[model samples]
Target chain A: MSGQQSTTSTSIGSRLLDWSLRGYVVLVFVFIFAPILFSVVFSFNSARFPTIPLESFTLHWYQTIWNDPDVWTAVRNSLIVSVCTALIATLLGFCTAYTDYRYNFRFKSAYLALVLLPPTIPLIIMALAMLAWFSKIGASGQLWSIIIAHSVLTAPFAMAIIRLRLNQMDRDLESAAWNLGASEWRTMREVIVPFCKPAIVSALFLTAAVSFDEFAISWFVSGLNKTVPVLILEIVQGNIDPQVNAIGTFVFLVSMTLVIVAQIFFTFRAGKSFS
Target chain B: MARTNFSGFATTWRMPIIVWQVLFFLGPLLFMIAMSFFLVKNYRMVEAFELKNWEKMLTRGYFWDSYILTFWLASLTTAVTSLLAFPASFALAFKVSPSVRRWALFFLIIPFFTSYLVRIFSWYVILAESGVVNALLAHIGLGPYTMLNTKFGTLVGYMTLTLPLVVVLQTFALANIDRNLVQAAHNLGCSPARAIYAVIVPLAKTGLIVAALFCFILSFGDFVSPYYLGGSKPPTLPILIIDTTKSGQQWPRAAVVAVVMMLTLISIAFAALALAYRKRASR
Candidate 1:
């Protein structure tokens, strides 16, 4: 009788614990996602303010932004910078990771640590430094300035991701090629490049997304030309434009897609299928 | 010939990265430090070294107030996020299946990739006078109370921004902890809650510290949320620096503020590291 009573109590207690855990997870999900959903929903509202009265839905906001030439110019600027940043960051990151992995050079650890430094430093501090450095060099507010800043910001991430893939690769494959009388350049072209391709692709997407969304540095360095985030900041500060919501929604979608693509590439590169 | 060529290639491979880091990474930081020591004459940086900028900034009540406010806000945000994330992370690490956990993590990080500005704007709209929160309050016959342009609003924004990172980091930390220790505590007649406090949290201390530091650094230096949601109050350190440099054209003072901010962050990070190291050593 005592055993039966204890078993029943234990079962009830465990069930209560399980329910509470589920509830906590659900609450956290809501907290994280409610604002995003609210914004996305209101982006289609015809009403000016995001407050709801079950208003009629329209695509006017998105249409307005699409037609805005200023926004288009900003988009172009952002794309140019993002692409350049991605390319530069990926190249530098790949070279760094490749060298660090293949050789035992002096101060290798210190060199890698320096590469990772930018991300840990505050964005405001870095932005300030870049602004000071750029103006001193007579290149303040230039696209090249923004590109360099963003590249420095993102290269560490690219290096870390690519280095993970490199570490996973079979070291024996390179040695086997060398032992088989293959030239170093030939072995790299045939073996290492192919092996590290997925990592490189993912790094491109990740860095592009980071550069695209970067605002603090771009705001400081873009002089007369504004990136998308800087433009959106202006819109928010000026008139609380509902049309900005449309731009925000679109940018959000694109950034989300880029990140998802990067993740998919990473998981595939890591030999882990979603299933 | 092949051996020499391979070695040369290996040696030269680091050249591009080295040049890139020196020119951009290390250069900017060094330049900023140098500029902070100079005086701004006629709104331009003068080459002459002076302690006036540092002395003037240190003397200002506003400077110290902004630092204090930023530190307080960051601490509050970090504490709240750590509290809320602890349970959620626990659930993610243990209660959920591996497949579900992966998707849950993906979901957690997806929102982070979206424009942070947009997310803040969404909160702004929701917290506005006639916005959703107030509307819901009216339905319940309660206050149409102010949320926007206040400390509460800024705190909300910071918490929302930092929560994902905290949760994700803590989840990984909890996942790495040995389950056997918790189970042993349970077998020793400790309650689940007690076991969590006694065993799990101690094991997850390093991750928790790292997450808290990340939260503090990101929130303390953030310019957007405090600018938008802080209403009329003196802005955070980042905003102060930006206004000083951009509008006031006080480059020296701005550089001084930036340097001070960086030093504060570095010290906090080092303190956390030292504490973690000490704990490990004793263990």
Candidate 2:
């Protein structure tokens, strides 16, 4: 009888623990995702005040965001910066990574560390330094200034990713191509580039995303021309518009799509590589 | 002939990379360090070196208070994030199926994709007086707490931004743990808690430390959360730097603060890297 009683109590305790753990997981999930869900819901809120109960669902806010010239300008600026940054960073990164992988050089580790340094430093410091540098050279607040700043900040990430890809590549293929009377450029273009294409693509998308979302460096370097983040800041500071929610929703959707696409590409490439 | 070919190819590519690094990376850093030593008089950086900016920045009571506040907030955020992430990571790593883990990983990536500012703004809507939390509080017959522009608000903002990173890193760490060790512990007649504590924890120590370091650095360097949420009492160091720069365009003061922050951050990173290396070497 005593054994039965003890077993019953032990089972109860275990059940309670299991329930508590489940509850903990649910609570954490809610905490992490609630704001995103809230943002999505409030975007459709017909009420002028974002904090108020939803009076009705309407597409008015979305229309407003679509029609806003400032929003378009910000988006345009973001795209231009991202595209330019992506191209420059990827090219530079490819060159650097290729050089590093193919050669045994002095201060290799130091060079790698140097590439990683900007990411390590506080963004504000980089922004301020760029601002000072640009001002001294009479190039502050220009679009080119922002582009250069973004490239400098993002090239390291591109290099790291591409270098990882390069390290894993079969060097024998390149040597064989070279032995087959292929020029160095031909070997790189035909043999190496195709192999490193996936990482290169990943680096491109990642750099674009990073440059698009960059605020601190953009904030300093963008003198007259504001990026989306800076524009969002201005709007928020000025007024809490339902339109801001619309804009936020749009950004969230676009960014989500980009990330999903990138992940799909990454996973597909990763699987292919593994197989 | 082969060696010379490789060397020739390397020389052609190497110079440009070197030039790029010197001009873009090292050059800016050296310039910033130099600016930190100069005197800024009447909104211009004077050529003469002066220690006044450093002394002023270091000696200010406000600077010390901000530093303390920033450190406390960062520590708090790291602790809270770790607490929330560890179990979720464990479940994802051990309990969930691979398909479910993939989905969970996708969900984890969502927060990162959203614009950072938008994420912060979303919190404002949730925590404001008229926000959902206060509405729920009111429904429960409790006082409606205004969370915006408060320290608590700042903490919440920081946690939301950084928790995903913690979860992802911890998941990566937990996934890498050897399964046989867990079974071995179980076969040895150890309780589940003891098995985890003795076997799994030791194996995951490096990952956990890395996650902690990542969280700490991210939180420490972040200025946006404090700016949007931290109201009248104290601002984070980055905000302070911005305010100082805006007032007089004091390059020296700004540079000093930047240098101090850089040194502190570098030291922390070095220490963490050393710990990681030591951990790896031990294995």
Candidate 3:
């Protein structure tokens, strides 16, 4: 009876320890996320100073963010860049993945490596390199320069996703189409493209998210013209205002909404594909 | 004639793709390499090649110090992130219900969606002297320590950015482990801790390595965290390169530093990839 009681007490003690560890993990999660949460909550604060104690909640910062021309312009620029980057990256990624997967060619490994290199390269280095290259030919600080840089940075991710989707596809379908006297172009358009459309869409959304959130590359490449990230830097460097929190809150909402939507779409398609 | 026609069509189609790959991707790298070797006068690569830039870069005491500091920061970030992320990932993978796990993963990934700059800005509100941590510290009767403009601030900022990645990757790795192997170990009179250590860890070692490598690379290459959080004297190669570039008098020397940083990064990446590939092959 004594031994059993001791064993029971030991088990209870270990269980308590396990629970405390779990609690610690949860606390760490809060530590990681609390800043963003504070930003979101404090965006509604009436006070101008972001760090001041909370007064009555107000929507004034949101109003200010809405009325600010520079904020809107930055948002518009980010939207334009992200959309263009997504479209170009997705199209190029599709073509590359299709060509590589369909045709057995020499120098395949080298080509793949070249395509994969940019995403893994340090962003600052790539940014500096792009700056140097563009400036040498006298093309720095242009909107199109930013667009091209974003495309280059995001295309590899698109290619990787599309490649994975393509690998899962059966080559026999393409061969059968060709055997039926269908032209290669027709087969790709009708069969391969349709099969990879879901992945292509996911790639577009993912690339857009990445391009929109990108700062290091954009900071170097964006001269004169400021994106949202650049604007955030300017705000933090210059002022400690509540409007920045409001803007951050809006950005957080938009990005999270889009990611959630994309994830749902991806999950549904992935499930269907597997089923 | 028919065989020749087919081959000709294939060649024509492949040519543009190859050209795009070379011009857009390989061209910049080659240009960077060449510029690393050439002297820059008035922001243009001079006709004469010189080892002066390399020599100057090698001799700079600050350059070597920043490199060491950068590596140390990255190693610390990787260690902290892995230590924190491992248990969290294990909990999500094995302990949590599937529905809760889904929601947890979603929450973990939400920060990744926000602008990196904005997220870093948010940290200022949390770590500043008058910030959240300090406020809490004061409430508890502890003196409020300044976190911003210090190495601790930089470390915390880096941890915030990288911890999510470690958790996500480790969770994916742990989820992929064969459950039966773990169960078999437990059934064979092995304690849960012993089972995890012997069977689960060895199986998940590759994923952990990859996660650590990702954190290391990201932290090593990071300039913004230190720039924003480290106040006046940030010790990082990227910041050093930026400062050198802005000086306008040391273009060639800056290029040499950039080259060295790139080479170090590439070798590390190459080694990690080789290790990952070897592990995958063995599996």
Candidate 4:
């Protein structure tokens, strides 16, 4: 107690606490990653069931899926839906975010509240609603039905991301461009869009990732045009299938790559590369 | 000023998005409410104004059972996730350096970006009766335990969904708490454990509660987890909705359950927001 560093017992106790805490964080990370690691590992094992004492490492499942035409159809559908959803969601997001950024209007908060509300609703309810509407309108079971639902589901995320980027824009950039004799649309095309390009790209990748991995809505609305996740679900329903593991590994890689790319662009400053 | 025509163009900017959101997002939700009141005739939904779907679903014992089970399961997930996440979050908040904390945040967020269904499916393998967990248990002289196709498996799926996100949220909340208060408590002869409970926890109460609430919201609405991992032995509300719609084409009946779920979420969200922002009584 005589000096700040004089207590020997407290020093050892604190050190023990520090090491234990570090160990706990390690354990939590293991818990998070273990299932993913197992999924990846079992995807490679030649054994059909994911049992212990792993079988000889083989790519037969991957080979089998590579030859399967139905799997290819799912992969194609997933790509089309995700790509279309990404473009539409990002466009809507930028417009909404720009509106929020540039204007002050009545019911603005309510407008925003509605715009941002999709992610909060239970997905099942969202699926049910989408299914009912699509079926009623004679649009159920189409690939585009999945696309439209995913856009609705993911546009809020797009809006949120672009809005963040917009908030960081200099207040006068658009104004200065307009004052310099550019037309409103030109200023928007030249200044605002370029300024928002990185965020737009980032939003596109993010929404695409979400749409790619999305299952519940796709399952409900995609009457016959199955996305990859729906196909995986069909395979795994009521029984185990090694085909699912192979498809899952591929889907995981695709989603993770998109997300990582998005994160990279999101962290980049708009003009930093040129600068 | 160029600002003269700005407002007009602003309308041009927003109208399309507003239309999109209203048409696709808000329209379906409102339609869902309407669909709940429609009648199903001969395995087809007929648009009408009636409360039979609501009354039927509301009065049924099975529907209410699912409601209660989903409620309790979500609450259990919230409670467990909060307790389990606290220590790791606390460590990240106070024990780690800033760089380590940032890396930790990135790792936690990576899981959110991946396929949540894949994560749950992975558990299905490990928790299976003849799978890895049981295989490992045999090596330890412990009898294999049945885990899959039970509430336990559902809980595991719920954990997979909520844990990483909760840890990310709770870590942010705890890290924002002032460190000096904790130090001051320690200097006042409070033990380390007491300082955490007395000072740090009180300061982070709102964040912790909100994080737990988010966990509740995620687990409550999840469909794949309860279906695949839990084996849909007794269907959760999400699975119930699927069954109703699938078997009899009772889309109206399914809509009733959807409406109830939405109402529940909106209520819980409002309640949590109130509690979180409630002004403290004068000391």
Which candidate number has the best lDDT?
A: 4
Candidate 2 residues lying further than 4 Å off, grouped into runs, are A1-26, A273-275, B1-5, B11-17, B277-283
> Candidate 2, A238: how far from true, in Å?
2.4
Candidate 3 lDDT over residue span B11-33, tens digit each: 65455545655655566666766
How far off is residue B201 in model 4, in Å?
2.5
Candidate 2 lDDT by residue in tens digits, B149-177: 88888888888778887888888888899
RMSD of each: 2.4, 3.5, 3.6, 2.1
> Candidate 2 falls in which docking quality class?
medium
What global local distance difference test value does model 4 have?
Answer: 0.88
Q: Ten consecutive residues with minimal summed lDDT in candidate 4 chain B?
A: B1-10
Tens-place lDDT per residue, model 3, A78-118, is 88888998898877777778768777877888877777778
Q: Report lDDT per candidate.
A: 0.87, 0.79, 0.77, 0.88
lDDT of 1 by residue, A11-120 (tens): 78877887798799999999888888888899999988879664899999988998999999999999999999989999889888888888886788888888888988
Ordered list by DockQ, greatest first: 1, 4, 2, 3
Return the TM-score for each candidate structure.
0.96, 0.91, 0.90, 0.96
lDDT of 4 by residue, B213-267 (tens): 8998999999888888777766899999999987778999999998898889888
TM-score of 2: 0.91
Interface RMSD of each: 1.3, 2.4, 2.7, 1.2
lDDT of 1 by residue, B48-148 (tens): 77889899999999999998998888888888888988889999998889888888888888777678888889888889999988988898899889998
| Candidate 3 wrong stretches, greater than 4 Å | A1-25, A273-275, B1-18, B42-47, B232-234, B247-249, B273-283
Query: Candidate 1, what DockQ?
Result: 0.73
